[model samples]
Target: MGTHRPRGETARRSRTLSGQIARVLPLLPLAHLDREFDYLIPPEFDEIAKPGVRVRVRFAGRLVDGFLLERVESSDHPGKLGKLDRVVSGEQVLTPEIAELARSVAARYAGTRADVLRLAIPPRHARVEAEERAAPVPIPEVQRDDGAWQRYQHGPAFVAALADGKAPRAVWQALPGEDWTLRLAELAATVVARGQTAVLVVPDARDLQRLAGACTQRVGAVVALAADLGPAVRYRRWLAALRGDAKVVVGTRSSVFAPVSNLGLTAIWDDGDDNHAEQRAPYPHAREVALLRAHESGAACVVAGYARTAEAQALVASGWAHDLVAPRATVRECAPKISAPGDSEQALDRDPNARMARLPHVGFVAARRVLAAGDPVLVQVPRAGYVPGLACASCRTQARCRRCNGPMAVAASQAMVCRWCGVTDPAYRCSACGGQRMRATAVGARRTAEELGRAFPGIQVVFSGGAEVLDAVKPGPKLVVSTVGAEPVALGGYGAALLVDGWTLLGRPDLRAAEEALRRWMAAAALVRPDGEVIVVADPGVPAVQALIRWDPVWHAELQLAERAEVRFPPAVRVAALDGSEEGIVSLLGLAQLPADTEQLGPVPLPASSPDDHEAVRLLLRVPRSAGSALARSLAAAQAARSARKIDAPVRVRIDPIDIG
Candidate 1:
């Protein structure tokens, strides 16, 4: 100890210094990487380098973002590694639950974890330019003598159980009309009143607006997160929820991820709408996301619509949720009187209503009565323009743009414009035949509106669709022509509704065509006054039309379920649609590890108007109910392997796809 050999030499020889010199800090792998990299944890962040949090690091000569998927005690390249720059934020953005959910979704969809995270959470650095104001007013307690509240009283207890963070499943059916929206608002309010957060998702912006308005009245302040909000405003709303300034969030599909503290409930309206499916990468559907959130947060989950989807029905049948439906008598009392074209006792002698018919007699009579009574009537059309497609007047050949084979629309000056590619041609001819004359075969909303204007002169006909028509619509005793999804009548209600062209809806080359058509019919029917009439212009013999005639959606759902069970369609057996080039698909089929007894329906050619194009073909696979999940996992794994092999073709796998042709 006397005259310890040079202090520096002793310090260097000490274990702490030697240990630091030999220590190799492990790198946290990013969500997306061809291979993991070696990174050293900086001494400053060593304590904070917990897995699942974001970290800044130098990689490939640049500082880039990365997620800490795991922490390791040592690295392979202990000598040639740079220390992590810093932890991005102390707050944990990716909780263990959220990380697992994203991972599961990525695996199920054959997508990257980063891609799934991108969908689940908004950009962390994107700041909303707004001062934190007072928090939104708490949801008001609603007291009602009606039986509706009798059910709502139990909502708090249900939500309290969910707050324990266990997936509590429940099915709620509202008596059609404003009541459905109100009941949902009340349930959300009860959750909020308990100092917990809530997320309410609807299928479309209009529905979001409606629900938001209802919630705003009951709950003093709420954040409406939707795509319609300009980027800055949307960011502000998102941040409000993130900062715990807003407890109630109402929005469309993207709002499922709204950061509501202490999430007690996650509710989705019309969970079956295809619009609820995110079109972006990872392609998570709102229903699936809601389910995942419920499971993760131990929140009460409720799926409500005017009519339940087969998926929802399956949930009830499987005992995953309780079916909260209005009593049969209550439903019958509120449902409108339904008239169908197929009623033999009241069949129209005039030309039988066909898919291509302009206006069915029953619908026409209803429209006339409603208009004459000084009330506005809604006329729902399947198509949206004056002429979405054109055919030859002489040879019945379809009119298509020669440039892109897109459907051509005729504008002023007799100009033909391709709706798809927007190519205009002054001189257009039918490609099927060298013909110039074109005929409009089917009626669209625009054409129907025009016809109604002329048929009922001085009656103020209004048209609504993809184009700007909301401003043009006014309260009046006239006809309101609209596309199935674009109906513009206000919430006050319409005198009557005419569901035209049932054949067009039922005959679609899609698996859920019937279900979708019935949903539309029910939506429009819900808009009519309870005493008003609903005329469905179709053969009452058809089960769908018959269900409408009886005003029984449950019957329709049960029948469809039975039929699907018999045919092994969705809700009975899990189905997957794999679409890709013929060769790629064939390879997938060849490599597929489907379970025994799983049926392979087709390598069927996709229906393209042209025969030369063979890039898209669909293979339908039906897995036994017990093996569906496994099959889906296997298909996703196979796709990932194919991608890793550097396959040049594209392969898409859709589980429980909405449309199956």
Candidate 2:
């Protein structure tokens, strides 16, 4: 179009469109098209076609959206470059830092950069982009207070390091009765006080609200990033941070990618939460993302929680991060008085059948006393809903649906249904016992609440779990029944907490079962008053339960790391999951050249993936941590090759799959 350039342009020689050229990354899911495409910056868009801005360009035969990666003086393309169709926005939504982060994450997860950016940057809102952006707010210096951090041995030192602009990595194990939200807010404020920015990522919107409230009084110019915020509002808030108008960002997983400049710190609370694991392609964990961002930005990294995960322990073991924890004496003083079946006094007074008791003898006594004392009693159940479990009343056998052979469950309406196939079995008879009666084999929150209400007739019974989780419960002589991770924080803390049905959590088939069970137990226990009691209804001898009794999660975490390392599992090694039709997986494997010491496991059937997935299987590749990058490249290259060949049945490749059950 430029002056009707000579036909054929000297046999496809470049149609020179000045020296200005822009390299753009098209937002397409195809792995084969992962790299930037050279595009000519026409005179019309020369002023607004800067890097990081959104633009539309012609690719193949259709128009596609892309982000301007950078400008180059010349292009290596031998053919004529496609001029950008137009600039979508003059505003740079994708900050260079975030762009770099997305690239690093893509490489780490063996995913296309486009996919990571899709998660990092929300969809653009034309109206929001046109709105006047907020001016940068000056960060207020917070008075350095050792209010909460002083409880930990190196906590105060960590804060001081941040104030001095020294980057330190810490795995913080919060003590019982500790105000973790307030502590996280103070940590962000410490970095902000130094005129830098900080990011605090939690697991859910509930935590986001609490954290946001805590930061308002301490961390100035704070903005929240969450999925629940409407598209326009979320985009406006994200734009605020990108414009350098916010000093602190606090929200859920997405906040880990906040584009605040002058980065000082990145922290994640309750990093082990399953909610923090992204379900999309690449499947990045928020904690890992925080660690990466902190490393790239030279910012302080804090992984704070009541319990330590195996990944966090690996950091401490490798000397990559220090353990910030309280001394034994201080921890004990703040921890609730714990009672287990193994304790001598409790054993002497315990009922003979305490081993399988839903409410242990000591637990019932503690709950009664706490309720009588006018303080709330918190009962933590492992599962939610009413009658989530069903058993044969006659033979004491688990009830299963006749059609799908899946476990049966009864709803609150007193109707039985198959948990897996969704078939109603109102007139069901036990296959083994031929009995039409079903009993609750495992008690859920609703059933527990109903039982507790009957046990304590005069007390109020509050339910906090499922679709209606309460953030906080007022202190009073009430009984609170909740599922793990859904326990409401009671003002001044509950008088006592009873962690019931612990066997369900400990018996899960997932790799993180033991660690997760302990984490959930400790999180619930942490909500009790210092002088109050915590009674967990599980065998005290189990390592996880023992860790809770001693209030030393590091012990369990270290043990887990050692155990997993011996088996070449995660945190010590890297594992990737490849699943699809046997044909696709096998073809992909044959195409990829795996690194040495790559152990192949499985070819296991994935019948549960879908009813028609009976023939689909999953194969796992385990490799040494040092070879993770090479392994990712090999897998990604194989995927790209398959895509290039136009293979219809695609194999799903995920590095560090959420659960290897």
Which candidate leads the pack in TM-score? 2
Instruction: Compute each candidate's TM-score over C-alphas.
Output: 0.79, 0.89
Highest-lDDT candidate: 2
Query: What is candidate 2's CA lDDT for residue 520?
Result: 95
lDDT of 2 at 605: 56
List CA RMSD, all candidates: 9.9, 6.8
Kindly list the per-residue Cα lDDT of model 1 for residues 165-245, writing each as its tens digit: 444677665554545667777767766666778899998877777788878887766888887777677767776786677
lDDT of 1 at 433: 67
What TM-score does candidate 2 get on C-alpha atoms? 0.89
Error at 298, model 1, angstroms: 2.3
In angstroms, give how far residue 88 of model 1 lies from its true place.
4.6
